[model samples]
Target: MTAEFHVFTCLSDNIGVLMRDTTTGACASIDAPEEGPILAALEETGWQLTDILVTHKHLDHVAGVAPLKERFGARVVAPAREAEFVPQADLLVNEGDRVMVGTLASDVIFTPGHTAGHIVFHFDGAKALFAGDTLFALGCGRLLEGTPADMWHSLQKLAALPDDTLVFCGHEYTLSNARFALAADPDNQALKLRAAVVEGQRADGQLTIPSRLQDEKATNPFLRADRPELARSVKLDGRDPVAVFAALREWKNSF
Candidate 1:
């Protein structure tokens, strides 16, 4: 049976999602930005929380974890490298590890950049990815605790996923990200069109998440760093893809 996902917003910009398997009653929480929304989502869906999947050790991501776990006696699955900070973590996963959400198995993909030990959960069967802060719709997270090179490689790992994958990231930053994308890639018709669409979506008080990986691959500057056109747009022609990616990240920080 297919998995059902409820993607919601919290903490001004953070995102929280709930996943439930239809065939079985297995349910999981993907990053708890806050408790109220998560609890509300659970009650609305009538899906008992069975597990908490953490992408990193960030406060916004784990703050509501304790409350939810107490309520449901859920298992908290977190990255091993940052286990000390994750409260009541029951399972510590690393790259290539398999984590089960009921009978469905999600692969652990280490995507450290936003944090030194950040990770993403990829459920190939569900055709969905819980990317947390490693990537965004039209942009990516800042290099808070990692080098540009580290983030670039991490993004490459995520980019390799199938184009049809639906990316459930951790925020509603697409409007601003689209503006920066235009500045960096003014000549991209697909990006320009996407920016307009994003503006309208935000203006109407809508969320632009669960972005397709195909769209990101075609337009996101970080993901398009290897393209010669993108390199020229950033005035970094002939540079390594990682360097171009670094320039884009720096440019975005101040954008």
Candidate 2:
């Protein structure tokens, strides 16, 4: 009884995901970015949608929720803190809660900063993380509503996950993130190699997502803010990791 996933592009750069539990044939959509693509994917795979796990209240993420639920009679699971915005949710979950899609279970991790109530789903058994707009490939979400310290703490929680974990983020921002990573950590050999790979991926009309957590830990400037080399790269030697993270984020805002 293993878990299976289908990744597809939706509404410009957004990524849509469909997860299925092989034991029970229960399927779930990570977020409803758009109904047409999601429905199309379901039709193509012949997997019935049973649940919609939402990460936050953002429109792009929730826009297709109601329509999909109506189409498939799927249960909607959303963050309790943002329940007001996600009026279609059938279940509201908080941090440390467990969400089950048939036999597949996911741990809910409250990850604010991208939005006040953002949450990511970690399927420990599958080593898969569905991070919506919170953590990108080599970058992280903008501090739209939360502080630098909040984002830093949130990132630390994710960075603590096993090295083998696979991260499926909400968008295809890896190319731009790679460029920023090179500027932020030019001396990083791993980053240089990754940037080259990302370049080729995008140039060939490919997706560079589902990135390995180990690769991110090595090349992502956001996750490496605590490292002395990253601090020196930003000329913030001896500064607190949170401060270094803040400087890197601010630099990325304009990058």
Candidate 3:
């Protein structure tokens, strides 16, 4: 059976998502950004969180995990590479490992950029992906612990997924991402148009997330580093995609 996903916000901009398999009523909480929101969502939905999927050991992502685990006995799954930083990880997974959420199985994708052990959960069967900080709506995660090439390679892996994939990222920074995207790829009409929509959404107190891969492929400057328009906008026309990507990341850091 397909997994049902309930997405909500917690903390400042962190996005909290819960996946429940209707067939067996097994539920998974993608990340515990805060105990209040996670527990509230469970109570509101009346769904017990049976598993906790930690993308990385970032404080915002794991701070409330132990409480939720204690409260609901939810099994914790985290990257084996950085289990020391993650609390109470019952299952240590790496790239290509598959974890079952009741009857549904999600493929593990190792995307090291924001952190060395960051990973994403992709349920191809359900066309849903929990990207964490690796990939966002119109931007990719900031390269903190990893190099630009490492981040680029990781993003390339995600960009290759089916275009219909619904990417649930870790934060709500799409409005700012859209603005910077325009400067990075000024000639992109699609991006300009999307930025307008994003502005309106934020003004109305709406969430502009769970972006489709196809739209990102077309308008996301980071993902379109190989495209000539992006290279030209950065005045590095005909440059290698990796080089362009590196420059773009640095530019966005200050943007």
- Model 1 misplaced regions, further than 4 Å: none
Name the candidate that leads on TM-score. 2
State the lDDT at 238 in candidate 2.
Answer: 97
In terms of lDDT, the poorest run of 10 residues in model 1 is: 15-24
Comparing 1 with 2 on TM-score, the higher-scoring candidate is: 2
lDDT of 2 at 48: 91
Each model's lDDT comes to 0.91, 0.94, 0.91
Error of 1 at 38 (Å): 0.4
lDDT, candidate 1, at 108 = 98
Q: TM-scores of the models, in the given order?
A: 0.98, 0.98, 0.98
* Per-residue lDDT of candidate 2, residues 1-255 (tens digit): 589999999999999999999999999999998999998999999999999999998888999999999988999999999999989999999999999999888999999999999999999998899999999999899999999999999999999999999999999999999999999999999999999999999999999989999999999999999999889988999999999999999999998
lDDT score at residue 135, model 3, on the 0-100 scale: 94
Task: Rank candidates by TM-score, best first.
Answer: 2, 1, 3
lDDT of prediction 1: 0.91
Models, CA RMSD each: 0.9, 0.7, 1.0
User: Residue 97 error for model 1, in Å?
Assistant: 0.3
What's the distance in Å from true for residue 245, model 2?
0.5
Local error of candidate 1 at 100, Å? Answer: 0.9
